[model samples]
Target: MLSGFKLLACLLFSGQTPTENLPAQDFDEYQCSGNVEIDFPGLCALLDMKNIPAVCTKQPASLTTETEEEDTDDNKSLIDDSSIWPKPCLHAELESEDPLSAKNLKISGWRVDEQIVRVLQKMLLSLSKLQSLHFWQAGLTDQMLISLLNTISLCSNLRAVTLEGNPLPERSYHLLLSEDSILTHLSLRNNRIGNEGARLIGSALSTTRSANKNLLSLNLAFNCIGDEGAAHIAKGLRFNCALLFLSLSNNQIGDSGAGHLAATLAEFALTHEEVVERRKLLLERTQDSSLRVSSDQSSVGQLPSVPSSTSLSASKGENKAKKKEASKKEEKPAANKENPKSNKKSPDIKVPQSKGGKQGSKEKLTAQEDKPTTALNEQVEAVEIVNPLLDRLVQYRDGELILPGNTTLSSLNLEGNKITEKSLPLFLTSLEMQGEEGGLLRLCLQRNLFSPDCELYVKIKELMALRDALNKNTSEQTEEEEQGAQC
Candidate 1:
């Protein structure tokens, strides 16, 4: 038995069919971590190995020891070295034969030149199965990102993406908001996605019918999002429920913006919990229905056939055919009515041919008569200078509007904002609107303009430390460093 098994193993390993035993190969990860020059051809070969899923390569220079680094006292930068000694175009040899097998790719601190950028783009274009990607400190810029837009859209299975330290422009980063994208985790740390980008992303996230409904984490740290942008995001977040973790650190959020975010967090939680419960109920109902169908089948001693793709297609075709027939029936009366109208209009149009001069003069006279009425309407509109402030209950800024008793936000990060005593009352009122179940768990109010002895400060402290008799914690942490001087 042992000899027979050995023979079978040898036969399986052998290429009897003139094809490699790709299915038997189990190479899943490739890691290159050393100071030596990376053999790009060898790396590509390893990645092309059957079933290889992840590839990680740290820059060789970063791994060099101090002693090894001191030996080369040349002041030439990576850019300068690349320019001076250009590597041979190894595109043919370096390209992966089976790039689609790669699911995760992580390349850190790469000295990306024009040629290398092209190679990277080509590699990404080939990776149809790629899910997660990280380009940390890769010298990536706005132009580079813009170039990869089409390639990025092709990655239908992509869920998580990190572009840390890349100088991504608004146009480049806007690709993330594509309806085809099913991104669940997006990190744009240190990328200069300004207020406009933030607004765009927020709007996309708010679309519950979008593929982004599965999105759970979003990090926009170091972006230049301000009060207006924050408010826009807050409005969108009120409708979104799938998001669990959000990081908006080092943004230009002010009191108005902070209040808007806090309100959203306080109110959005309830809706999120409700959605979870609804999904659970739906699953239970589906399972019960399946069980009933199985039970009915067993009792009848006949298995009821499930609808196949062909049957479904045929049914759809029949429905379409019926709808077409019904449409044709409906169109007959409409066409008859339109025929009479067309006949009458044709006569009226033809009658003008005999009295063209008179018709032209009459039309000109009507146009002249309507000119004063149009001018009068414009004057009325100009005279009525509507006060925008009157339209709102709490007037803060131009575009930062927050609705109380209508959010489900639980965690809020409004640190380093321009919040003062004046904004505190409104903020507290909004929090109270959340009721017992909607209290904020985390509130960051550090480096804001607030007096120590002010009533707002005292109230804020009280709200942060709110507890129950059973020692059930409602709030977790409140970041309130007194770094700023009292106003």
Candidate 2:
């Protein structure tokens, strides 16, 4: 009976089960052996298999010919209007969950060559929804970095990128931080960026025409930036308003670098270029105001006159009646000269004929109209003249004190650098002067040459702590208000 039962079980289970066939089916599904349209999943599989040629090859013409034949005129028009050719199959099937949507692609420990760059260019162009990209130790050269940055600049949705450990041969890293860049966070740690790179980055941050208005966080730790580089960055910070976090930790910065950075945090006189730009802006405002006033006066003067013939005739008749009454009054004035009370009333009747009252009123009106324009021009001239003298004098305080230095940076990380006790006082004085207006909430000074119990360091820490507490309270209140609004 046992032998019979075993034989029966073997007979029933002779055919392959569904689970047993799954592996073969999956392998065939993933394999891009034939001329099939590659989607996101196929792209991932090809990448895993290191099949670059398969991904870069053009799709079979047979697959698109049928669609082209079936397309209507409107569809053809739309296809012609679209900027991207051979539309990507990312969302071809309208899948609810897209692999590349809001995803981060991290390629580490790989030697990216020209073919890899081509593949990346294609992928980046297609994956418009990709948020962040990280390439760690990818062996990128200067030309490759430039190509990658140019491709990234086209992606409007990508917000953050990390290229740590990929030190380039030249200072092309600043290409990623251009004035029109959309990236909000960037990490170039361990890249060995030096003074030249920092200077380029500073120029990109704030230039003559525009500044980088999008970047919020920058990480430059584990680099070779020194005093000159720090000064360059501080010069940029004098005009930048959007950056909130800067990390210069583990660098070659010293007291001179620290002093430059500290001066940026505190109030300072505007540079020559800044003063010139201010004058230009003031002149522009004055011109705009004068134009607006002139336009208003012209509009008032151009108001429609009474066009109806009946109204014109009525006005003419009234003027004639006034002339006749004036002539009669002139004759009465001579006859009434013998009566003293009558003579006084005759002068009162003829008051409208005198030119003094009308001329005085006209002069007042013209003066009022010219007052604003003259005052504005005078102010602009005053600024242009006084600014030069103020720039020359050492003790001049009457000049405009409105152009404060950088006040938007919230955090600065200088830990593991060569900063010492001598530089600590500059930071402390800057912090104290900033008082309630400083945006710096965190300043990392650890592992520097200064002692932990340094008085200036302690005071700076205390001020930072107070600012942090206040910021926390403000954030909490904002959150509560948002919740209440939702409710």
Candidate 3:
């Protein structure tokens, strides 16, 4: 008896493996046309089934090509324009109990259309746990690739991708480089990419943010890359340090292109060294500032509150003045009480001034006194302790100066191209451009236009010597640091 796994595997991947091959009964009910292979939604429906056995038992006759064509003709009669394309109204419903559960999808070598892309995008949107996607030689144009990318971007868990053998364009590069992409391993081998497409790929890789940071391996082999395309790629390498493996093999690269690439690498090495030093200096400064602030805080804690004594003194002075004023007021009131006739005379003398003046003066005095005390307290609290280290920490949190590490461009194959002594010199010059600690390890320049006694041979020897020296020096430095730490 066939299980659910076998049934789903059969629908998704037909005849790839013995287990994936559908049972005779199941294959007959698939409702696919003769050699057309329009089983995409049928496979999607299999993934959506709550009870595979129950759904598979009842094969709907409406899914047959005959019925579909008849439905299309019926819908076409209502419309005036005969040019309108027939829609694939097949539905892949969410019949499963768990809404979050989703299965990965892998389709290859299928003919593509606008309707197919739309249906695919809708199906991808419905899935929640799509991990990887592989589409090979699927007849994708620039617009189709864009549509696929837009749909893939919506899948949060999609990381690995293989889109080999598609005729992708420059715009496809832009879509892949978009910040929304989170692919880690992307292969575009045999894509027939041109100069503009290569430039777009390079530009996307050069992004210093999370966009291309996740990308580790990229395969651009079999793309016809000339000098112009090579230059743009070099520019991208100057800024991108996350990629560990890249292939440009089987391309139309010449000596000029090789030299351009070499120069870019050398320049990047020098710039990277300078950046590392600057970062170290800035880090040290931040650390020092942080220590200073910490010390200040500790000392502040140990020291007495300096404002307390002054505040107490001011309060005492105000209390003494208040006591004196009360005594004088008491004397005046007593004198008024003793002489009723004098009180009447005094009231007449004061009159309108006494009615409003005393109340206003008392209110003014109270407000003025409260304002000063509150202001003094606030001013003490407002003593801003500016910590430069804290500011740097904030910058780090905001993703400044926290770039991905520089990984050397590994696996360069410049096989079968017009390379001569002229290209050799430029390539050698580029190697010399590498800083003392450049990260170019392996290079393939075979089957190129090189003579036996070309000056490039001598330059290559010199570069090898420099590389050895750099490695030796680094090892020695590491040993010395270790010894010093022990001491």
Give per-candidate clash totals.
11, 0, 1
User: RMSD of each candidate?
Assistant: 19.9, 21.8, 26.2
Q: After superposition, how far is residue 279 of candidate 2 from its true place, in Å?
A: 2.2
What's the C-alpha lDDT at position 281 in model 3? 40
lDDT of 2 by residue, 1-487 (tens): 4433332333234443435532354322432222112332333333343432222222234325533442232223222434233322221211124323434555544456765664566566666556777776578888888888888888867889988667778878888888779999998877788999899988887753457888998988778899999988888787677899888877889999999999989877665676556446545555765675566456545545855787557556645654564465456542232235333423221223234665545434333332332334423343342222122111112232234457789888887788999998889888777767556887778779989998888888887887774455544433321221000
Give the Cα lDDT of each candidate.
0.48, 0.60, 0.50
- How well is each residue in 1-487 modelled by candidate 3, as lDDT tens digits? 2345544554555444434444443422444321112244344343443322111110233235643554344323323224343332322222233333333343433445665565466556555655666565566778878778877877777777767557654448556755446887786766677788888887787633222556776767666778888877776765565666666666777766777776655532224443344445445444654564466456545655565876557655645654564465455532232235334433211223342565645433333322222222222224432211111111011112222223356434454456666766655655555444445554555546776566676667566555553444434423321221000
Q: Indicate which candidate wins on TM-score.
A: 2
Q: Rank by TM-score, descending?
A: 2, 1, 3
By summed lDDT, which 10 consecutive residues of candidate 2 come out lowest?
Answer: 478-487
lDDT of 1 by residue, 1-487 (tens): 4433332343343322213432343223222221112223323333342221223332324334532342132112211324242222221111133322555565544445444454355455545556777665567666776666566667666678877656654436656655556677877766666678777777776633332456666766556787888887776676554566566656677778776776665422224443343335334444654564466446445423676787567656645654564465465432232224334422211223233575655434333332222222222234342121111111111112222333333445555556666667767766566557444544455556787677876776577657222123212222111111111
Q: For every model shown, what is its TM-score relative to the native structure?
A: 0.46, 0.58, 0.46
* Model 1 TM-score relative to the real fold: 0.46
After superposing candidate 3, which stretches have Cα over 4 Å from the reference?
1-40, 43-106, 125-130, 207-211, 268-407, 425-438, 451-487
Residue 114 miss distance in model 3 (angstroms): 3.1
